[model samples]
Target: MSDLTFENVTVRYGTRRRGLTAVDGADLTVPAGTVVGLVGESGSGKSTLARAAVGLTPVTGGRILLGGDPVHRIGGGGNPRPLQMVFQDPYSSLDPRMTIGDSIAEAVPRRVVRGSVARRAEVTRLLELVHLPTDGADRYPAELSGGQRQRVALARALAGRPEVVIADEITSALDVSIQGTVLNLVQDLRRQIGLSMLFISHNLAVVRYVSDIIAVMYLGRIVEYGSVDEVLGDPQHPYTRELLAAAPRPGGALLAVPDDDPALLAVADTEPADPHHPPPGCRFHPRCPVGPLVHPDRQVCLTSEPSATPHRHRAACHFAATTDSATLP
Candidate 1:
């Protein structure tokens, strides 16, 4: 087992000056045998960070280390791929024409197995690891249920015996009832294999369910990070607090529409910061409700970009120290 380490990693698209900075100096680590959840709103760059780890997306600056080796150098070619991705949409990830057995076998490194009998045996074992029936190997992805396809995808990712697994919203496309089944399967696989994982999603609740640590991203930067309880339960960043408040809970009354709530409207009216031309100072300050209402904090937020500092928890906010946990939703 190996840890996945990112040191001041930055990923951009096109030229540096004119391009979009999807991830900005992200420093993260997925320790061996543990899961790290990355939560953020749409276009927050959580997905980009995950892709950057596996070399799917290019890294514009800094580096990623897996087990003390440079990931970018080795990620492009390896017998057993160091990192494997389980994408959001299982249907799109798998080939409709290929049998599930073939798909899983295609990932099996030549070093791991040879001959038709060995390959077939390996496919059966992979399916069994994901809790899929042995017969499932004979069927195409289209014939399987959503949950089944996801499990097949997982089995395929594991076929290479990857050191790190990047699960990008793997459950978002499934039915509510089926999501639990897939999540449970992931949990089981994690314990059995002790594989380091990066679980990226916009659903805080889902992230909390699986992650040991959580990182909250806002406008391409990590705004808060800590243990799942510390970050999600007592969020320091205003954006994190807002996200938790917006999430609907069971039996809770419907939230007022954006038109009815000034705060919600403010959030809705403000467009996400452009990656190509990010807002000055705190990227979140323009839409932040606290910065405007608070006195001295407002000045700091408008003039300086707070560095992500660790003090029990890491938060990039000028007033994070003054934030009252009791007042947060």
Candidate 2:
């Protein structure tokens, strides 16, 4: 198992002088044999970081290291076996024209591709690993249910014999009844294969269920990162608190409001922060609950950006250290 580390990674688009920055110097890691859950609202750049890791997107700055070795582009002179991604929407990811066995065999490691028998055996093994029927491999993608297709996607990713897997909302497309099965299969793979993974999802409950550590992202930066318990039970950043309060509470209970109204969560009332015209200081300052909008004395948020480094809790708000999640509202 190798460590997947992002060293101050950044991704920008259009042009350097005036391009929009999608990921602003993200410092994160998926340790040797663990899952790191990346949770954030939409447009938070979570998928950008995942795409950059697998060479699907280019980075403007920083290095993506796999076990201390620099990662190269997947199709640009680099082997894709070591790092693989199971993208969202499994139906589109699979080839309708090819049989499932053929698709899975396509990703099997070169050493294991000696002959038809070997490839068929490997495909069957992966099919069983993902809790699918061995005979299903001979069928086409259109013949399978959404859940089964997703399982095939996972099997295809596993066919590569990857050291690290990037699960980009792998279960989001499945029915609620079937989400648990996929989530359980992922955990089982992690245990059975010791596969390190980066699990990205918008559902905090799902993140808490499958992650050892959780990283909360906002705008283009990581605002809070810590163990699942601390980050959820005792959140340190206002954005985290906002997300918790905004999430549906069990039994119709509501989380206590953070210092101000749900301005950030109230996406309709507030203008979405644009990556092209990022505000000075903190990119999320405009929607921050405890920013100058709530208290004029907190002008630092408008003039200075918070810094984040690896292996540290990155409560990227200026007032995070002094404030408590319960005391916010």
Candidate 3:
């Protein structure tokens, strides 16, 4: 079992420019062999958090531990192959001119594996593991369909024998038909390999299907998180409630709404009030529907940052102390 933990992790960009805190002090645990869904709308820092997990982006603050060992510290002569990332765009991730086999082989260190024939055999095995045709080893990425290319990308990530896979918006670009196949394949891989994953997406329906636990991000912070069934079936955060209301439902009818004031749209469009220089209290109060109900105390939500304390379910809102899931729309 491989466990991945992020403790108060923060990722910020820029020097002179107002450094955008892409990920706030977010904390999460992907228990050994469990898949955690990190869901949020565009620019909510879902992808940024995933990149930090894989060391693709430097973490400005906090720690990322794999099985209790620090990720950044593991490069000092330890095998850092336990964590890997499968990106959102399969086409751009792959080299257009390279054969699929060669691409997969590139993942391994040159000292550990060498020679073209040996590499070809390894690539073929990986393709089979990802349920792709061995003939695909000879084709370039463009020659395959979107699903096939994604399979190739998975094969490449798996080739390293990674225990945890961070898939960042991986299926968002595929056709609905192809998306299911890729999701199923990932589910199959997890069961077979005992792989723990951080599946990032803005699509709530897809996240619900793929994750065991769900973490909802807004702006740069995780506003709500819990077991998938608990959080989705009975979301408590005002932001979580709003997000679900906006999501399309199966019967073509909108879900119950907490508030319908169009004024909220204007707040949503503006830049997430800077996290570093966030408004004097609850970072979310500016757009919170219940802001007025808890106005004075809501000042804490705007001025002082809220901590993510565990509850039957957890939400960062100031009124979280008084709000009931049964009361949510």
Alpha carbon lDDT of each predicted model: 0.84, 0.84, 0.79
lDDT (10s digit) by residue, model 1, range 189-291: 7788886789998887789888899988887888998999898778888888877878876688333344565556566677666767887889887777567
Tens-place lDDT per residue, model 3, 22-127, is 8878888888888999987777888889888877899999999988889766532323377788998887989999999889998854554578788788888888
Per-model TM against the reference:
0.91, 0.92, 0.88
- How would you order the candidates by TM-score, starting with the best? 2, 1, 3
Error of 1 at 65 (Å): 0.9
RMSD of each: 2.7, 2.8, 3.1
lDDT digits (tens) for residues 244-263 of candidate 2: 87777778766765345554
- Consecutive 10-residue window with the lowest summed lDDT within model 1: 253-262
Looking at model 3, residue 278 earns an lDDT score of 61
Off by over 4 Å in 1: 75-78, 253-271
As for candidate 3, its clashing pairs are 280-302, 280-303, 281-301, 281-302, 281-303, 282-301, 282-302, 282-303
TM-score of 2: 0.92
